[model samples]
Target: MRRLALVLLLVASGCRNGGAPSTEVAQPPQTVRNPVPTAYPSEKGDYAVTELVHGLEHPWGLAFLPGGGVLITERPGRLRRIDPDGTVSPPISGLPDIFVDGQAGLLDVALSPDFGRDHWVYLAFAEPTFRGNKAGTAVARGKLEGNALKHVEVVYQQEPKLSHGTHVGARLVFDDEGHLFVTQGDNRVAAAAAQELDKLTGKLVRIWPDGKIPKDNPYVGKSGARGEIWSYGHRNMQGAAIHPRTRALWTSEHGPQGGDEINIPRAGGNYGWPVVTHGIDYSGKPVQGSIGRSTAGMIDPAYVWEKSPAVSGMAFYTGGLFPQWQGDLFLGALAGKSLIRLELEGNQVVHEERLLTAREERIRDVRQGPDGALYVLVDAPDGKLLRISPVGR
Candidate 1:
């Protein structure tokens, strides 16, 4: 039905679906409409979407503690710790001032894999002003003392901090080798960085734990580009996860018109940004590469949304809670207002289903909390903290 809606709306309105303006339609805005889905459409969940922590100003990143509780970061430059029992810890101190303009601020927070012994948390954020108006993406290490971050030190900083914060794609994953993989969106201010080898914008980078550039990164020897780049040509990467068993790094990124992409970021892979896309230009103008033309060197997306569900977060389901969901992919959608579950066979997506669509809510993030339940944070004022566990046995 989702695919049918896009075709019908496109045939009717020429172009439609997503937040694209009518005048900017690559074709014309389609007027196709479809009924939304529901797990329990008759009524809201009998269980409360419950408030884990209130008073947070636009929280972005969420990480669960080993013993108990979770930590979240507010975009306005504060780190908070919330206990499962609903106790909100005071804001942690020692964060550097950020260039909090539009969409830029303190971002993704995750504890170190060695946290049990290290007592440290890792963070990504917009750095203090640099190059006048632009600011860099910074990764810092801070010690957790009681409820505050102490002995904070930035381990990595992406260059050309002058780009106004548009794409701060900061998701952290620790590879089996203990190296860190970090994703950064192509800060709208810099488009060329996506193709540039040395620059960090619009790229997924790999680094050593202490903030050192990994000696084995693909572009370490490339001149003019930063050394941490694992892949290039990405625009606003938001969803990323290390596959449960394959350990291959897969990422989901936002595209302009209809091309949102799921890519495997191999060393030095070029993902075809402005040069090529499945989507048309936002202005409805022609951009490079027509749809589905078997490009030579460039990698094709594993899955794409013609209607662009505006993907945000994703993870591979390995838990027994949703036995049917095992080995599938769970994705959060913003514009489509849905939770997309992609049925996969190896690297191929066989089928896709929506868990939440009619709600018209923007889902920002999804993760497996410490309690072994799937947790999702909606991106709205009525933003909800939904604990998606298996129906009680």
Candidate 2:
């Protein structure tokens, strides 16, 4: 009876239309046999976690500096520097006006690959309109000096800013070739925009560090398409990283209720969102305009969570501190309140381990420090910067 009711609800919500016929089928959902375990043991060794600092207001992003200091961004529109000895600097000044409402605000921070020579810092944030109501994701770059950003300039801005604040996907990643990849969400009220070629929403865009569209971009010379779009048909892609070995871009997207995804976003790839998805609506009904779980032309996710973990930041573990963990993938979970580690063989995830479940804190961002230690940012009114190391040595 329960299954029948769900089928009826799907039909009523119009879940079976507007998709190309396909022979491919979506992967079966994996159930969490044990939702939360007391301890997470790995093949390499046991883990120890240290709280380096606390008292942050919903810290969202983290970047390690050349001189051993860490830069952290708060979602409420502040940036601060934390020294190696755990001293937190006051909020850095000279950031542009940021839209801070609901899920919108200062999102991610990154240092330019040439930071040693250029000192350029890149930031992804929610940019507001002159009216200060509608907002969209934007990227800016500036030189860092003392406690402030100097000569900040907007590099890229998503078009058609929406009034809603949810689904502001703003993860920033730089590829080995010095191209900047910016992820944008569908703005909660605009899922259909993901499939539109001319719109920037729900897309992954690649640009030069100076915000110029690359000539080799998939849509560079295409008619009626945004030249900056590298790939389309994404949902809310909050987590992104470049594979250390492959140099390919991997992203983690948030689905409506379930169906959180891990994807390798290829140039011009279409990742089905409302057209095909493994998840239903928040109200337990099928997503509107969704056909089945697969479509003929859209690329299926490389990995999916049947139960939404509300994934956020992700990193590739290339550091040598954990020899066994090298080449693995680490992701921070907001809903699951844990750090997820996936063992990968090439691009395939063969094993998954959830860490820090005992603490039950929302993990926002995860990164490998200069010293090869795993660092994480906890999202809270009293957020914390945590360092994860081997139990000994």
Candidate 3:
């Protein structure tokens, strides 16, 4: 793999409350790379798809930089930068040791909301235990220097790391109040952990950028409950996006055989997982311990799929390029192998459209670029970064 050292313009760390430390580095000039374009038709209109770059190894998370650059994370513990012109940089250095195994490793990446000023980058990955036998999801942040991260520190870690590998929900999102939300999945072997307030598994946690637990967090003073927890009882959430109009945090979760869900998680909310679900087990039997589809204390999903699409990344389209798609929700589907677009009437999904079914690619992540176009990452050994723009625009 190419390991190019490109310097990024650095600024003084104006972080409050002793945030991640910063370093001084010089910036480099920007250049554009040629794009290979393809066209496709969608429900709203025809669009052109351009392959900006390729050869990524199971790229999972993607975050856009201030000046059209993108930071992408590969599942096998590598981070790369993609320039606007389609140039992919080499693996960035300074990441913590990741526990790479089945459905684990370097996962999601996000820029601090104040990235232009602070240059802080956040990451979620499967962190290994001392013995290297058990692992759990962890969140860390660092200052983005030239071609590496500096002063990286783990902000939060899941308690009681487990030996299993699957169901490590690792999506990161920042709410309107600047609070960071980290999604966690119930490590497949511990489904009941989702219902326990003492466990971080299968829960969404809210914290300050500097790792401080917010005083107003749902369980701050509750006995035996972790203060960072915001909501619980999720299976394996992989997609999260802030709603543009309502400013609420929305997420997509994977179901067993069916019953994939989209939820607007609220403070202290509990969306039933093992206790209740619409999906059956992989063996075609009912989910173990599930009493019914709905229960008295457990909150129901805002929307659910009778068939699992295996949703991953998600974004709310507020860009001008797709005016008709404004306020619509777009989710990347792994098993469905397409980009799923949902027409939303407030919080409800009114209509649905599946795009890129012809390509049959496992869409890993999706975001609307600053240029008013949609960008998606394909999950594969030879993954691609593709930009979708309205036809002839």
Candidate 4:
């Protein structure tokens, strides 16, 4: 009884003097990151879509915390946080020097496999060179402390940073074996680099989480070949996800005019980016002397979209909130302004469904949160973080 009275007295005194922290968590800020009620139609009927966080500028990546928080990365080189209670924090400090160019900046963020215990996070960003003019994709590892990143370290960097912005493919994926895969672009300045064995650009690299080359990687001991190369001859690949059942790494990349492709990448494979494409150049001319769609030695995509939708981020749905969506792949589209759902049977896409067409939001990143809910980040001047769940679930 005395303890209860003392607690009540303390609460009263704290309220009177405004000195004690409230037991109640802070509410979502009214000016920013506020919940905006919205109803959007989907194949499942009218569903509930809530804008949980707003006022973000061109958000590119999102990762949910196991404890109920979220980390959002803005392409303009800022990393923001959303507390468990829905309060958005200011940009966390201690990020590495980011080269914020046209298509480059702080990109993807992923929690380490042992993140619950180690609290280590990884980021992919466009990094600058010694000259301070050229830049390319790089990966860094850091420890997340209170509200700042501590003990940050650069783990991997693509060589020969060039001075362009359109194609710094920056997606990070982790396999079950703890190997990290990084997707890079052709750097735009040299498309031929994609076919070269020595260059790291325009390729998928396999490395240990700490940036060491995996000994079993396809190119590990090959002379004149970068040791980290897992698969070569890729264009600007930005979206990659591991299939839940097959454990295969599937990637989607941008094509010239209309040859966006979805591929199941293979070890030491050549994707024939510029050599053979169904797309045409920006000038409406056939790509590279009309190389046709196939070559004897090059591999073909598992699926090709004749009309490019500008696919961005992707994830395989395994949540029970939407039972019908299990085993399907969800891809965010920037130019198409919709969330694409692809029904997969084994390794083939059986059917495709477009969702959120009415909202017409440029979905930059799509992720399945820890709570079995779907989260998407819109890319815009006034970007928003959205949560998607069943109407009454």
Clash numbers, per candidate: 14, 0, 1, 0
- Candidate 2: misplaced stretches above 4 Å? 1-44
Total colliding residue pairs, candidate 3:
1
RMSD after Cα superposition, model 3: 6.4
Candidates, ranked, lDDT: 3, 2, 4, 1
- Name the candidate that leads on TM-score: 3
Q: lDDT for each of the candidates?
A: 0.66, 0.79, 0.82, 0.77
Over 1-393, each residue of candidate 4 has an lDDT whose tens digit, in order, gives 000000000000011112232222223222233344466776656656777666666778877676666667777666766554444565566666777668877788887988999888888888777655767889988888866678989999998676366688878999999999998888878878888989988889999999999999998888999999999878888788899888989998888788888988899999997888878888888876447999988999998888888988888999887887889898889899998999988988999999878898999889887667788889987787777877754
Model 4 local distance difference test score: 0.77
lDDT of 2 by residue, 126-185 (tens): 887777777888998888887667898989999878736788798999998999999889
Top candidate (lDDT): 3
Which pairs of residues collide in model 4? Answer: none
- Predicted structure 2, TM vs. truth: 0.88
Which residue pairs overlap in candidate 3's backbone? 33-85
Which lDDT value does model 2 have at 206?
A: 98
Instruction: List, residue by residue over 1-393, the lDDT tens digit for candidate 3.
Output: 111122222122211122232222222112225554577888778888877666666778888787656677777677766543334455566767677778987789899999999989999988877766667888989887776789989998998676366898889999888999998899878888899999998899999999999999999999999999999999999999999988999999999999999999999999999999999999999998899899999999999999999999999999998898998999999999999999988788999999999999999999888788888989987777778887765
Could you give me the TM-score of model 1 versus the true structure? 0.83
Ranking by TM-score: 3, 4, 2, 1
Cα lDDT tens digits for candidate 1, 75-116: 656565444333444455556556665677767777788999
